[model samples]
Target: MNKDQVKGVGEQIKGKVNEALGKATHNPGKELKGDLQQAAGKVQKAYGDAKENAKDNVKRNAR
Candidate 1:
């Protein structure tokens, strides 16, 4: 997988951990931040998927 995809997945997992920790500790701010991070990660992953798809299409056309 590309760096973006890998990084994005990492961020998502990190966010999930943070969110769970925040919930366990009753920290609203941290929970919100984690939720935002997870959302950002999802967006990044989607972008990565789109970019990879476009690249594949280009390569196929080139052939």
Candidate 2:
């Protein structure tokens, strides 16, 4: 996977952890931040997916 994909996945995992921790500790700020981070990660992952797809399409067309 590309860097973006890797980073995005990492962020998502981190966000999940943060969110869970926040919930357990009863911290709305951390929970909200985690939610935002997770969303950003999803976007980043989608962008990476699109990049990979486009690359594959180009290669396929060239072939």
Candidate 3:
């Protein structure tokens, strides 16, 4: 996987942990922060996926 993909997955995992901790501790701010992090991670992952797909298409068409 690309750097963006790896970082995005890491952020998602971190967000999930933070979200769980926030829920357990009754911290709305932390929970909201986690939710935002997850969303950002998702966007980054999608961008990485698009990049991969484009690269693959280019390589295939080069033949």
- lDDT by residue for model 3 over 1-63, one digit each (tens)? 788898888899989988998999999999998998899899999888988999999999999
Question: Superposing every Cα of model 1 onto the true structure, what RMSD results?
Answer: 0.8
Which 10 residues in a row give candidate 3 its minimum summed lDDT? 1-10
User: Would you list the clashing residue pairs of candidate 1?
Assistant: none
- Local distance difference test, each candidate: 0.87, 0.90, 0.91
- The TM-score of candidate 2 is 0.96
Residue pairs in clash, model 3: none
Candidate 1 at 9: error in angstroms?
Answer: 0.6
Root-mean-square deviation of each candidate, in angstroms?
Answer: 0.8, 0.6, 0.5
Residue 25 C-alpha lDDT in model 2: 97
Expressed as tens digits, the lDDT of each residue in 1-63 for candidate 2 is 788898888889989988998999999999988998899899899988888998999999998
Candidate 3 — which residues are off by over 4 angstroms?
Answer: none
Summarize candidate 1's per-residue lDDT along 16-58 as a digit string, tens digits: 9889989999998888888988988888888888889999999
